[model samples]
Target: MPRMLDVSDEVRAEIGDEEAARLLAGESAPGSYDCTSCRTPGDSAQERTSTVLFIGDETAVLAFAHATCLPSQVVQVTEEQLQGAVRAIGGTGAESPQQQYQSPQHPQQQYEAVQQTPQEPQPQAANLVPEQAVLGVTSGLVLLQGELHPALVVEPTAPVARPGSLGSGDDFLPLLIEQGFMPLTELAGVPPVLHGWSVLLAAGQLHAVLQPSPNGGRPVAWWQAHQPLQVTDGWRAAANKHQQVLMFAAPVGSIGRQPREDLLRDALDKAAANGKLVASALPLAGI
Candidate 1:
C-alpha cells in the first residue's frame, strides 16, 4: 500500500495542477526557483522578496527578482508580439517561451501599436562578386588533380624559347598561347608546380622548391596557365611536379595596365593566409 501524497495550499495557490504535475514528474522545475539572475548566495531578504510573475499555460511562477534583473528588456507585449513569439516557438507543437503575460485588451492593442515596424533591406555586407562566381572558382579547383611539382619547363609558345626549342627543348610555348591557362588534364600524374620554382608568397615569406627553374624564367611554366586554383584549396596537392611555380594573375585593371611581381607576391601571400587561392596555374610571368 502507498501513502497518500499531501498537497499544500501555498503550493496549490502558486502553481496549477497541470504544472505541479509536470514539476513533480521532472518535466519542468517549480516556478519559484533559483537562477543566476535572481538569487545571489548572500542576497538580503528584501531582494529575495522582490518577486516577478512569469506566466505561461494558465500557470504563474514567482521569480525571486524584478524583471530588470534578467538580461532582456521587459517590454509590454501585444497581440502581434504574442503571435510572433508563438511562431518563433513553432506554436504549442514545439518548445515555447517559459513565460507569458496577459493584459487588458486595450493596453495590448496600444502596445502593439507602439511596436517598431520592421524596416526593408536590412543592412548587410555589400558583395563585390556574386556567390556563383565564388562557387565556380571553388568547384574548378576540386576537379584538378596531382602533386605540385616545380620545374622550369619551357612554355610551348613564348617570347623566350627554351634551348633546342625547334627540336631538343620541349616547345611548350605554343601550347601556352593556344591555351590561355595550363590544362590541368596534362599534369594529372606529375608532381606539384612548387617542385620547380621558389614561390614568393604574399606574406613576404618564400617557399623554396625541390627543383630550381631551368634558367629561373619567371618561376612558372607556360604550359601551366589559366587554370583556376585557390591557395586555400591545398596548392601542393594540385600542382604538377614538372611545373616550377603557381602564378596567380589578377583581373583586368586589378594591377593597373601592367601587373607587377610585387603585387602578385602580395596577393598570393594574402590568398595563402585566407585559404582563397584555389587556382594553381595562371599566367603571372612578364605581366
Candidate 2:
C-alpha cells in the first residue's frame, strides 16, 4: 500500500510547521497527536495529529493509524482530523469544519434534493416470496444477460430473508451504485417494489442476478455478477470486454485468493489485446 502524500492546507495549519514536516517524512514519533476516540498514536508525539493522505490525484482518501487500532479508527480519525486541524489553527469561519470539504456551489442544491426526496416504503413478503421461490429452484436460468446491443440487462430477483419480513438484501442498491453501475431510473421512482431486481445499463449491459442455493428451504440470498459481451455486425458476441471488472461468479466464495495468479495473468493478456486495462483486487497479505 502507498502512503498518502498531499494533505489539505487546513491540515497543515493544524499541525504547525515542525509537526507537519515530521509526518511528511513518514515518521510517527512519540508525543504526536493521536485521535482521542481511537487512541491511535499520531504522526508526531508532541501534538495530536492523524495523517490524511489523498491518494492518486485526490481520487480517494486513505488514512493510516496504529496497527493495534480497529478499522473504525480510520473512520473516527477521518471524521475529526480536518475539524481538529481547523481548530488548532484558531481560525473561525462561517462554515462548520465538516463543510469545508464540500464544493461551495453545489452544497445547497444537493441538500435540497435530498430533502425533497421521500423515503421509500419497505417491500412486503406477499410480492417477493413468489419470485424468490420460483427463481430459487430454477437451474441455468439467465440470471444476467450479456452481449446485447449497446447495454446489459441485470435481472437479480430481490433477496428474501423471511417469506414476509423486511430483509437487508432490499438495501443493496446503493452499494451497487457505488460500484459504478447506474441504477435504473425507472426503478428509482418507486421504492423496493422490484425487491432486489436492478438493471444497470452502460456502454455494455451489466446484470446482477440472484443464484439459487441447492437447499430448497432457505429463502434465496442475493449475489451479484456481470458478463461483458460485444454486439457487432448484427451478431451477439460472448467475449469478456470490461476494464475494472468485478466477478463473483467464481466457484469458491472468496474471490481474493492468490493461487489463481496464472489464470489472472492469462485474462490480463486477453484484456490487453482488446485495448482494455485489467485491475485485480488482491487481499492484504497478512489479512
**Number of the top candidate by TM-score?**
2
Clashes in each model (backbone N, CA, C under 3 Å)?
A: 46, 14
Looking at model 1, residue 142 earns an lDDT score of 19
Model 1 earns a TM-score of 0.17
Candidate 1 regions exceeding 4 Å error are: 1-142, 145-159, 162-196, 204-287
lDDT, candidate 1, 1-287, per-residue tens: 11112223433334446543543343433233232121222122223222222222322223222222332112122223233322322222444225332233222221111101111111111111211111011111212243332222111111223334454432232333332433332223322333332332111111111123345532322221122111322332232222134443222222222144345434434543443322233211100
lDDT of prediction 1:
0.26
Residue range 250-270, candidate 2, lDDT tens digits: 111112222333454343334
TM-score of each: 0.17, 0.20
The true-structure Cα RMSD of candidate 1 reads: 25.5
lDDT of each: 0.26, 0.25
In the order shown, what is each candidate's alpha-carbon RMSD? 25.5, 19.6
